[model samples]
Target chain A: MPENSAGTLAPPPAAKPKIKPPRRFAGTLYRGREGMWSWVLHRITGIAIYFFLLVHILDTSIVRISPQAYNGVINEYKTPLMGLGELALVIAIGFHALNGLRIILIDFWSVGARHQRLMFVIVILLWIVLVAGFAPRQIMNIILEAQGHGSA
Target chain B: MTTETIPAPRSSYTPPRKRRVNWEKWGWLYMRVSGLFLVVLIFGHLFVNLVSGAGVRAIDFAFVAGKWADPFWMVWDTLMLVLALIHGANGMRTVTNDYAHRPILRKTLLGAILVSTVVLLVLGILVIYTFDPCPSNAIAGTLPAFCKAH
Candidate 1:
């Protein structure tokens, strides 16, 4: 017991438990490799595609109103910004679908668990090939349109 | 008479625990099942909208109206909409539970997801069911080309 300024006996100060500082970037998005990275990217692309689906549904549903109204909304998608956005969306979908396949294989196939890392690598490689095949054409179109040499 | 008291025999039957709903397990199952369906639905959707016939340029009000005129397309679109939305919302719920450290934040995120998913589903369903390609009161110039025939 310790005495206060009034000289009355008071409860002794509680022992302070030693708290360790958290490691640098502990429990963060950047902390993991391979499977962890796949998990994080899968969550991210899933969310992105989810939001895209919401917008796509809403936009497509607008055709019920009138043609002009629907076209007015969709015409904005022709811009360079939207073209790039579409490219990103394609990339997201590519990764999500591939990674989802990997996940399915892991869950259902006996040998999938053993080669999950290999599967992840394959997914990434396939994703790169898909994006590489898709993006350049889109980028070229955007650039060509910007330069006023628009291709029909 | 040295009769030894026998210890009571262990109960042969163990009591069953109360059965609670296993929501997580069901949610996991739903993701896989719905995902399998989504692969086919989504790829078909993309193929039609971007590859079939005249491709993306052919997609417009008339195209959608033509497709919806068929009951098969209507059913396909509706099923895709409902399945994908539920799958996505449930997947997001898992993400929120994993990452959202604070209780209030987690609940709020989940609530938002639920409300948005429900609202979108309702809106999509309404659009699918109530769609009229050829409205009587439509402005003549703004109407889809097919509507002109009527």
Candidate 2:
């Protein structure tokens, strides 16, 4: 706070950085614990779902093109490969939705912010239950389709 | 030496624009509100379409036709399409803002997101509403059972 003889404020004592801020695009991964991982996961899942939703609309629009055209396209979804892919899609969607709800609660509910880590655990548990229920059915569906029973 | 003038810290700062409305705040709110609805709507959609009946094998022209034949499902589909596109586009915008520091790249990406969102929204709603589940020209097996009356 010293002023020079010229009555001007003295320059800040040659500022030196104690620590450098992390630079973006340095090809270095910034590490974080649970909260950051959750954010990363949410973004990944969201991007995946967004892409799928776009394609889904395009494919569904095939119905208007012609019934046979739609059926031909939709039938591919029954294949074993697509069946497994659907499982992964469900998992992505499952996590995103559950985590999204957790986020909402954290913002809206008073105690939610206090117990975010706990809420994250519960979200995972519920998602597991959800996927557990759906996975078996999906496996069964794939199995049945493989066995030539398309009505499974 | 000249009286080196030093403007007060934080005094030189000026807002980039006069933001009359907080679009970002509204966008954030939209994400949460629409997300709540999407969870229920999407879960129900998955359960009914993918889990129930014969699973993926059950879907076809007839299957989709059967669902859209009902007004309830049409409304549900319409709502989901509108809400999900906006929510997703807003999310993408946030991501773009976060990482895409280059002005040209950022604007291009945001522009693409907006364009795609609008295109898909219009296309999806049109497809859902203007859909002819039972096309007169549709082959016999392609149409749903109720189409027998047609």
Candidate 3:
């Protein structure tokens, strides 16, 4: 036994490779660039919209729940802060919508690789239109009311 | 000893169909383009809502009801709803196509996406427009009298 223990070489210990923190921006969209950022943002907004949708449904159901509570919630929205929240909802919905349209075109195979920029421009323009059209009222309403003048 | 003389080689044959553009080329384009838009739409949305003011605490029922009450917000929201749903559905459609190998399964999934998008869009729009924060027939002490035609 002593001879065998001494003569036989112990099995080589398997090398435990150092595990680096999983690459921070591994395989990010567009090499960790704008496109990647957009992608991450889109997914985040999508999830946000979905959560908002659930809350939205429940809140709307308050019409049946009790008008008092519904009205109370409604009044809460009149504040400047709530107005801003509405604006966010607008922005999220706008992005989701316009980009979604681009996605629709892609699904139909209407736009080709040559027109990626074209389509991107179109979606951006549409988003701009949506935001521009809605944001002013939200902003102005809050501003005017704060200054003691009703938002006309 | 026999010496063999090799014959000259004939011209090579070529297929005529190599010049066609592929459908997938279009699909790839769509992914990039749509992805670009989704970014702005999404981020703008986040900035406006969660970062603009008091953030998440400000969200409430009237907040939504008030927005929808206006035609401007109505149109904005309606557009957003339709677009987001379609973009999402379409995005999902691309993922489905890439993943669903079987022809029948692919078609079925695509069809489902189409149907669901249409249905959801319709329902969502209806909710936006037909929303009655204060119903006329609401129970006593429930509805604000403004809703009742005096």
Per candidate, the number of residue pairs that clash is: 0, 0, 11
TM-score of each: 0.77, 0.83, 0.44
Between candidates 2 and 3, the TM-score winner: 2
Instruction: Give the DockQ-based CAPRI class for model 3.
Output: incorrect
TM-score of chain A of each: 0.73, 0.77, 0.66
Superposed by TM-score, candidate 2 places the C-alpha of residue A134 at a distance from the truth, in angstroms, of: 0.6
Q: Give the top-scoring candidate (DockQ).
A: 2
* lDDT score at residue A140, model 2, on the 0-100 scale: 90
Query: lDDT of all the models against the reference?
Result: 0.80, 0.87, 0.62
Our model 2 lands, by Cα RMSD against the true structure, at 11.1
What ranges in model 3 sit over 4 Å off?
A: A1-35, A144-152, B1-150
RMSD of 1: 13.1
Error of 3 at A44 (Å): 1.8
For the predicted complex of model 1, DockQ is 0.23
DockQ score of candidate 3? 0.08
Error of 3 at B55 (Å): 20
Best by lDDT: 2
